[model samples]
Target: MPPAANRPRAVAIELNAVLVALIGDEPQVLTLENGALLPSGPFEGDHPTLQTGLRAWVERQTHHPLGYVEQLYTFADRSRAAATLGRRIVSISYLGLTRERAAAGEHEPGWQSWYRYFPWEDWRGGTPAVLSRQLLPRLRRWIDAAANAMTKRERRQRVEVNFADATWNEDLVLQRYELLYEAGLVPEAAARRPIADPLPGAPMHYDHRRILATGIARLRAKIKYRPVVFELMPPDFTLGQLQLAVEALAGRPLHKQNFRRLIDQQGLVEETGAVSAETGGRPARLYRFRREIVIERAVAGSKLPLSRSS
Candidate 1:
């Protein structure tokens, strides 16, 4: 057996949740601390499991019940140690999907748009002006300030590939946020440098923003191979409504015809023999997700083809 001095010490565990919902085509996340942080609390010794502890705290903090919850990631970075006052703290985070619900009373934390903390991630209309007008130039300066030519080149390459000049990859949410943090262009990175403007997006307390990024990236990737997005939708929806919800989450414009074709090919949804008069142009057919696919299929994919610029 090893000596007592060589044994590793135990660390405190924490539970954080990135609960997501969509309101009128805008993707939002439940937040606490006056929208400055995600709902989180330390894991108590009496709690039977990590998930139960998480659910308890989330319900207590937000007064909202979670649905379709899944583990997002565990973070134990050295920077996070400050929050525990030199003790090691491990944050186990979860991603949850649900429809927007009204608060029972006025005192709740309430849902805030996710884009408030990630403005550059959204591209449903087109590239966010903040990217070209502010972020890209700052990123270029950051790359140029690298210690060596090779480092500069590598940084530039990563930026290009992740941002994809004319075309954007919605799945790179976490990568983009980390790049900004390293460059000290975000408010959260102000401790590293004297930030001037600090970009447009709001900053969260501690590493909550980074955790949120992880959830966003995970959801973007999962939607391509799973029908999880249905958790955020109503019982009956039109093809246009479904496409809008996807575009809102993906932060890009999707080709309408291609999107409908992909959904039809997968047979993931079925018409309800109803039409929605809410649609402006004409009454559109309503459809409901086919839950049986969960048992019958091995894996299903939701293909979202991007719309080309005119």
Candidate 2:
């Protein structure tokens, strides 16, 4: 084949948005004042690297210097261009972790629960009844209505992927949204016309809903293998608080006994002999994350032997 015909084309990268705010234990995600999302425009000029560009874009928009950041994923649906005034836009998404700072120079910003955008993701209390009561029914109907066998198979695959009950895999957050988008059940896709109303969970403008999923999925998966949870927590907290934070991230209740055992065995915390007056039921001792764990034993990575049997 001729070089021109065989050449791989480069995607015309455009500026996209970065969604941020402090949700749970740490400064989590921030919402845009417009009730849209907290995303930054893409690079209008050259930058040293993608991380640098993302950081600069966020600082410019929110005046919050991001601390820990990693690429989330890229969203470039063909439909994004259908209603636009120009070319197909591809948003290179990123997740940045930072504590909320004073608006650097008087740029008022909005702060909202990251979960407000995806209520279903908050499993702290338990697997949201809506998942089984509402979403699953609709999803199953969508799965059954698949016109052909291949489409049906695809739907099943996605369901198994996101709602892995045999074992709740925390990493499929974004994949779930993408699958829903593909099925046209989500608002952003063209096929979404049939389901005009939002599902039980909260919604965001345009592709922002899916973006929120991306963040949730990333954070959930990260907690298992990283101490990123501390980034959202106070320097000192009780084991109960830690469990609550993890549960919040996981969007489900955990076995409290098992959770405490896991934390104590892991040596992830150091007792301060300080009672948290903020806790009501009983005075709880406060502790701080062993600062060295991030370097020692590689944070030992968080893990809870969670079971649905409550």
Candidate 3:
């Protein structure tokens, strides 16, 4: 180990925001750098707190206000330090949920579908072709390249669980991303290696993609035990619209009948005595989320019924 004085010192704190929204039937995230980066800035003493700083940066960069903000995770790996200065960089990430809005200014950051960054994670129609055709083979080679039997076996087990063919787990977003990173199949990993071809997906600057993965995994798990999905919903929406939003975030198709049953049982919404003519079907009743349920109950789980094929 190097002497204490010779060690790299913490030089900056960065606040990154993973702002998510459901637009049409796609789950979108606000991105900068032509959809290759999250909105982030250096934390300065002028802000009263970390969250305030994050809010200020996001608003200034994207020209949109944030809602339902929560701290995601902090990253301080040595490799995440400034490459040229050899100074440590601590990144504090946050997850923010909001309705989609047009960019306020000409140069504001725009929204891009999150699936563009994790193509294999989307299963709305069926299993994404990228999984078996691209990812699995590459992962198998990675597993076999392990030096020892024990290491190979452990890698295989992780791959099996995280990328299982028969069952898809929505909450494994971070695990899948990390596996790809470890296998050098992502651009971030390739940046550290001599590899040429990397898996398809828009890459972010620094570890912003990893932080987005963490936010995605957290949201997927959170919707199961809390009604936070309402934050992305409009004041009045048809059941079909609600299901589409859930499916978009979960990255899978949901059984319509079962989904409505779950929502009805939870009493999360009430009929608004209005109908939406734009549903592209027979007029569907509009419903508003019952905000009181959030206060009345300790836990209001949004039990999404996933299609087995997903």
**Best TM-score among the predictions, by candidate number:** 3
Model 3 per-residue lDDT tens digits across residues 1-310: 9997788675789999999998877889999888888999999899999999999999887778998899999998878737457567889999999986854467877788999999999888777899989889999999999999999999999999999878678899999999899889998886678668888888887898899999999999888888888899999999998888888888888887889899989888999999999978899999999998687564655666788542
Candidate 2 Cα deviation (angstroms), residue 54: 2.1
For every model shown, what is its TM-score relative to the native structure?
Answer: 0.93, 0.80, 0.94
Task: Order the candidate numbers by lDDT, best to worst.
Answer: 3, 1, 2
Q: What is the lDDT of residue 241 in candidate 1?
A: 93
Which run of 10 residues does model 3 get worst, by summed lDDT?
296-305
Q: Which tens-of-lDDT digit does each residue in 111-219 have in candidate 1?
A: 8899999999888767788999999998888898999999999999988988765757889999999988988999999877788888899999889999999999999
Question: Whole-model Cα lDDT per candidate?
Answer: 0.87, 0.68, 0.88
- In angstroms, the error of model 1 at 222 is 0.7
Candidate number with greatest lDDT: 3
Question: What ranking emerges by TM-score with the best candidate at the front?
Answer: 3, 1, 2
The segments of candidate 3 whose C-alpha lies over 4 angstroms from its true place after superposition are 1-8, 81-83
Query: Could you list the CA RMSD of all candidates, in the order they appear?
Result: 2.7, 4.2, 2.2
Name the runs in model 1 displaced over 4 angstroms. 1-10, 81-84, 102-104, 296-298
